[model samples]
Target: MRKRLSAQIAARRKQQVPADLKGMDASLMAMLDAQIGDLEQRIKGVIEQEAASAAKARLLLSIPGIGPVSAAMLIAEMPELGRMTSGEAAAMTGLAPIPHDSGAMRGKRAIAGGRRALRHVLFQAALAAASHNPVLKPVAQALKIHGKPHKLVIVAIARRLVTIANAILKTGIPWQPQPDS
Candidate 1:
């Protein structure tokens, strides 16, 4: 779009402009193009930073629903997971559903809080984890059997991941996803 606009402006410049003014316009166009190039470089730098995040994500990937992006987001955004309880961090990730209860009639469980982006990645990872990670399969299967919605089961796994990640971060250990006997 910028290229097209630049070309259009150049076209107008050629049609209605003195020779002196044309030189000035060309300079301005060069400056604008330089700025645009700089902006593109900055954007690349920001995207590269995701690698640092992805590194942490690698650890989480071992457990269940947590790939590089999700892991990176959690590490970059929630690096303090080490300070929180497994469950607390899990709840913070919004993996745990909110309990909606009032008087005689109790309300159904619903998800309320969490890092939605990280949650998304976690669940995406969970789908893959459920198939390969022996430990996550049964839990996923059970949730499926109970008619816990597919998304919910993934969220449940995500919650469990927070717990595990927290523990690992705090303990300086990797996750040990054991097989279900």
Candidate 2:
């Protein structure tokens, strides 16, 4: 909605319009920005509150790619994080690849059927990890080097992120990037 409004404002500016009308659009954009800011602050406050209640959230945030939003989402949406296996965690997030095969025929493995919102948030976090997290960056690079498609690489990273999150939660340890051995 914010993006759409910004685009509309830009478009309006490009067109020949009355000054008053342009000003109205600018005013609306400012209002939208303020609303967005307010919502972000509220989200931050809620996340902070939740983190206080669940120490696991603080542990989750210690991961490079996992921010307050991702930590809060995981704590709220996936209460089974610490108790689940890595594969189970990935499956829960819809990052696990599903196998498809028949006698004398092998079909492609694809990911499906899990928490969609959690999957989306994991993907976003994966993208950040791929670029910014030292420990996970090589995983993304290796997948790309092996000719994996962009989305496939992202899903793989998301799966890894879920596994890492699970491990940290289970162990009650903050993330410490280890050198590849």
Candidate 3:
């Protein structure tokens, strides 16, 4: 909405816009920015006050691409992280590919039927990991070389991320990136 409003304000400025309209756009943008900042601060305070959440967030932040928001979301939404298998973790995040095959015909696999919100958040994190994570960058590049769609590559990375999260939490150790053999 802020971006939209800014675009609208720019467009209006190009035309003959009144001073009042410009002021309104500026005020709205300011309010939106303030509200976003306030919410982020509140979230930080709440996370810090909760011992378990703080621990989880710290563990998650040890990973290359996982940030505070993603860590918080994972802690809040998926409490079963450490207890699950990699496949289970992937399925929980809706990153596991589901196969639909009829008799005598193999069907293409696609992901579906899991926590939608977590899936979206994981995808966002995966996008960052694909570009920046040394551990994940090669995996992403391999998929790209094979002609996988951008979305598919990200989903694969998201699945790997959930698996790694599970391992880290279960072992109570921060991620230590391994050099490629």
Task: Score every model by TM-score.
Answer: 0.63, 0.81, 0.87
Report the alpha-carbon TM-score of model 3 versus the true structure.
0.87
Evaluated at residue 22, the lDDT of candidate 2 is 79
Clashing pairs in 2: none
Candidate 1 Cα outliers beyond 4 Å, as residue runs: 1-58, 179-181
Worst 10 residues of 2 by lDDT: 1-10
Better of 1 and 2 by TM-score: 2
Question: Where does candidate 1 clash, by residue pair?
Answer: 53-72, 57-71, 65-125, 65-126
- Give per-residue CA lDDT, model 1, range 75-170, as digits (tens): 756877778887788777787778888788789888777777667667777787777666777888999999988778877776776777787767
- For model 2, the superposed segments whose C-alpha errors exceed 4 Å read 1-22, 50-54
What digit string (tens of lDDT, one per residue) describes model 2 on residues 1-181?
Answer: 4336556657766777676787777787688778766765776677667644358877898998987768767987898999989999988888889989999899999999989988988888999999999988998999999999999999998998889999999999889989678
Clashes of each: 4, 0, 0
RMSD of each: 11.2, 3.8, 4.1
For all candidates in order, the CA lDDT equals: 0.69, 0.84, 0.85
**Per-residue lDDT for 83 in model 1?**
85
How well does model 2 score by local distance difference test? 0.84
